[model samples]
Target: MAYEFTKEDLKEIEKLKTKYPEVTPVTLPALWIAQNRFGHVNPEVQKLVAKTLDLPEAHVHGVATFYTQYYKEEKGKHVLDVCTCLSCQLCGGYDILNYLEDKLGIKKGETTDDGMFTLNEVECLGACGYAPMLQVTNDKYVNHLTEEKVDNLIESLKNGEQPEYEKIGMPRRNNIK
Candidate 1:
C-alpha cells in the first residue's frame, strides 16, 4: 500500500531538521516520524522520508535496513521483543520465547491471527541483569519473565491495560566514583 506523511508529521520533521546541521543527522528522526505515523517505515515510507528530506532513497533505505527497530514491514499493534542475547539466553530466554509462542499460538517473527501481538526474537536490550526480558511495543521492558507473568501480561494487554512492572535501577558502575 501507499504511505504519505501527515502535515503534523511533516511539521515534526521540519523541527527535527533544524536540530541537525546536515540532512544525514535528520534521517533517524525523520524515519522515526514516518514510522510513528505509518506504523512501519516500509520501502514506500522510506521513499517518502527520503523525498521529504531531499535525500537519496538509497541513503534512507540503508539507515532503515540497518535498524531492526525500524520495522521494515508492517507489525501488529503490540510487538513483543524477546531478548535472546548472552545473558538472556543462558537464563532461559528460549524457554520464555517458547512459552509465548505456545501462549499466543504464533512463533517468533510472526503475528497472531487477530493482529494484536507480533512475536520477535531480538538481541539483548542491554538489560543483562534482567535476563529473560521482553519489551512491550518497544517501550516497556518486562524482565525476568516466567510463564505466569507472561500469561498475566497477555491478559492485561488483551484487556487494554498496561501491566505495571517494578522500576529497576541499573547497577552502580564501579569506576564512576
Candidate 2:
C-alpha cells in the first residue's frame, strides 16, 4: 500500500484486494491498471507491485513480459498491427507490412518520428477472408489491400475518417439470432 500509486488508484487496489482474498489473484488486474497509467511496465512498477503484494519483482516481470498485450515501451496513439499469419502471408501480408515500413520509414516494433503510428506484426486477427489485413487502433482493419488502398487508408486515418467495416463478422449478442 506504500506504493507510488495515486489516491484513487489505491482505492481501486483496496477494492481489488477485498474482492480477491489472495494477493496473487489481484496481480494481473493490478498490473493492467498500472500499465494503463504508465503506458508500459517498468522496473519501478514491477518493484512497487511486488513489494505491495509481498511477491518478487522477477515474478512480476515474467508475467508482464509473457503477455504481448503489455507494452514494454511507450506506444504511439495509433498502433498499426499487420497480420503475419499463414493465411495473411499467403495473401501478401509480408508485402503489406513492408509497404507500411517503407511508407512510415519505420520497421516492425518501431514508432514513427511524429509519434502518430507504431507498426507491429501480429498473429491472425480473425479476418482470414480479409487476409493481408492491418488493424489501426481497435477499429479499422483494411483488408485485401493494394498499395493505393494502403495509402488511402493511412490518409483517411490521418484525416480522422473512420471507415465502415461491412461484409464481415457480426457482433455477438446474448440472445440467439
Candidate 3:
C-alpha cells in the first residue's frame, strides 16, 4: 500500500522537523501522525517514513515497537486498555479486567467481532490514585470499575456519547473542602 502524507500532515511534519533540527528528533510525532492518519502503522508507512527521514525500515520499526501507544495492527473504533500494574492489581484490577473480558467477549489483545472495540491490558497509566483505571480511546476512566459502570460506558459510546469522567471508587485527592 502506498501511504501519502496529507497536506496538513506534511505541514505539521515540516514544523516538527524545523523545531527538532534532526528528523530523528521528530520520530515520535511523525509516528503518531502516521498512526492517526492510517489507523495503524502498516508496512507501507514504515517504508515511507524510512524514505522521508533517510532512515532504515528496521530503525523506524524499532521506535514504533518501543512505544506502547502506537498500534501496529488494525484496531476497532474504540480501544479499551486496562492498567494492570501492582497498584491496580491490588485494588480489584483483575476483577475489572475479567469483567471487561466477559462483557466484551474478547480476550486481552483482541478486538471484538463487530469491529467496535478492542480490549488490551497495559502497564501503569500514572493514575495510581485511581488504581483500577482504564483508558477508552483518549479518555481515562478512573477508580475501581464495576460491571454496571463499564456497561454504561460502552452503551454511551455506542450511542455516540462521550463519557464524562466522574470519580467513583478511586481515592480522592487531599486538601478537599
User: Comparing 2 and 3 by TM-score, which wins?
Assistant: 3
User: What TM-score against the true fold does each predicted structure earn?
Assistant: 0.93, 0.75, 0.87
Point out the higher-scoring one by TM-score: 1 or 3.
1
Residue range with the least summed lDDT across 10 consecutive positions in model 3: 137-146
TM-score of 3: 0.87
How big is the RMSD of model 2? 5.0
Model 2 lDDT tens row, 4-115: 7777777787789888767787778788778766666676787777776678888888887887666767787678889999999999999999999999999999999898
Top candidate (TM-score): 1
Candidate 1 on 21-68: residue-level lDDT in tens?
987889998988888888899999999999999999999999999988
Against the true structure, candidate 2 has what lDDT?
Answer: 0.81
Better of 1 and 3 by lDDT: 1
Question: What's the ranking of the predictions by lDDT, best on top?
Answer: 1, 3, 2
- Residue 126 in model 3: lDDT: 84
How big is the positional error of residue 108 in model 2, measured in Å on the Cα after superposition? 1.2
